[model samples]
Target chain A: MVCRVILPRQFRAPELFPQVQREFGRLERIPNHVQFDFSQLQFARPSGVVFLSNLTRYLRRNGCRVTYCGLDPSRDPIAYMDDSLFFEQHCGRRLLDSSQPRPTTRPLMEIRHTEVHGWIGFQLIPWLSASSGVPETELAEFRTCMSELFNNIQDHTEYDVGSVFAQWYPQEHKLEIVVADFGSGIPRTVRTVEAIDSDANAILRSFDEGFSAKSRPTNRGAGLHYLRQNVLDNLGGNLRVHSGSGVVRFEKNGNSHQVKLCEGSGFCPGTMVELEIRTDRIEFDEVNDGSFEW
Target chain B: MVVVVKDLVSSCDTNYDGMVVHKHVLSALHGTDSVVVDFSGIPNVTSSFVNCAFVALLQDFDFAQIRSRLHLQNVNRQIGNLVRDRMKKEAATVA
Candidate 1:
């Protein structure tokens, strides 16, 4: 027996017990003892929780033999399986208002050189902000920019050694995300965007279009470009990039400021991105649901 | 074969009969001469189902063996027209 699972695109899986029962009834001619195969299903929203629960219940009630394949068997199911985890940790985080006294002043958590996975970054940022009482809007922007930067580091930085260290200052209303590695830097990532090794300035120019690096697959290369627009241009944040001894500082709604490279103190062999998101005016209610006692 | 017929959408529950349909259309075409494949209940045919059912069978059976023996019966007007207009495009790619 075969139970072909069709993956739905929408976020919510409306329980269709009637439809499922009808489908099963129509296929009742098949013997009960035959083995059941479930394949080719994809989940689009709320991650996978609702669907899994419904499927498990249906299969159990039917007394059908079932086999599952092709599902991404990640060890930690909650990270991807729970849709709320992404929002609670990323988009809905709280940011301290620019006007209020900072609620949390802890240094940004530092994750150095161990490869930064997407989920880890997704979990870490909001995890850090939980203490700060960040505003929701700022948290959303932070999640977007942070996702782009973390993805860039994962895709671009291929090296012998690497690390990321970050600290968020509530009093200053700024978050510093620093990723450094002793490997190929942005200059190398730039080469794939264009044919020439164009000087550091031209390389920086490539960032304006948010073009993706040709060397990588499935990349929306606009991570840095998006970071530039939302963080700096839209939200009045700051972006600083240092690649191969070339330093460029970008302030929201301002001209690109080029500065002399300091003697490799903040610079090492890889890329270190420092982004300051202003969050001094936001209140705690804006950051969290105000349901948790912590 | 259970065909799920919804206007403009047809989903076939070929779960049990899929293997038979696969074998007839791919290798033993003559083996299915007495049987007619019914997609009347299918309202919409999806790629995921096709990929899971039809495309998968092609891996084990050869096409020439079952082309003529496989038959689609009770094709509804709305579903049939929909198939002609929309599914035809996909059929070309899948075929």
Candidate 2:
């Protein structure tokens, strides 16, 4: 029997997840044939596009035959989805709804962990820099922040594939990047190594410097900490991490930082790291001028 | 001996690449008085890279030995901070 997932009109994350989780939260629960009904999807956020693409891949990886229905290229959301390469990455085919992926769209990508460095340096950094006026030099820190998240996903997740969706909004001078994967989340992974009482606590604790999910604990825990520091604290960007049922959001409020931890952000399969960068605000790094400090 | 990071890995990002750098650094240390890791062309690196390439060295060599033997050149604040932060933590644990 086929399970038809009728998506909501506003097809975005932090909301779409809970509804979908009710369908395929566990591997044992996936139906033989899963059909994603995107007819009702009127608005698609980067997070939602990447999440759905990732969920589809996850289902297929678990032996589910995934199919899409109710795609109307004439609709604004469908056209946007086409421009984002959502259907292309999802099915290796495009609706040809738009002339091309468009210059403003970063396009969706399913990058293996091994290819992350190249993707970030060769494609992601250049794309973000081109649209946002964020110098590549200043974006180096952003690259480091992203690399840290990739490191976390590589170390913690069972899947090697990470689906990414990025969009550069030039008018707003903002860049949105979302990377999602089908792996054991921060909570489940942290629970393996430490005695964390809750998912929110596990994610929050991961932010502590020198915390690693490795059972023996190597030099492995700085990914989340550095990400939180650089993206939220240093650069005044936004960072949201969704894994298991935990959601950690970092927002800058005047001089103070807003750290919100939600224990019930629903079940986000694997983990999703979403970043909204104020591309106009990035500046050059002044310290550590190519010298070692002993 | 100078271990140019770009020469070791096309992109300094993954654990496998980090391990590759670690082995090369170990070999360089054995063959020379000191090894300077050149991070000129590499834009940014991850903690996995730093931990495997630099911090793990603390286990085999003390902080003093690391300070004396292993050096970093062209290290930006981003990569340098990751290496230093991780190395300090591992060095403390070893001590």
Highest DockQ against the true fold, candidate: 2
DockQ of each: 0.01, 0.64
Question: Per-residue lDDT tens digits of candidate 2, residues B19-93?
Answer: 899999988887888899999988878877877788777767778988888889997777777788777877887
lDDT of all predictions, in order shown? Answer: 0.41, 0.81
lDDT per residue (tens digit) for residues A86-202 in model 2? 787777878983436778777888899888877888888898788777678777778988887887877668777898888878888887889888888878878877898878788
Model 1 lDDT tens row, A34-128: 22221333333221333233333334446755444433423132223322222122223312112221223222222433333333334544555
State which docking tier applies to candidate 1: incorrect
Chain A TM-score, prediction 2: 0.93
Off by over 4 Å in 1: A1-123, A135-138, A192-199, A253-268, A281-294, B1-95
lDDT of 1 at A37: 24
TM-score of each model, in listed order: 0.40, 0.90
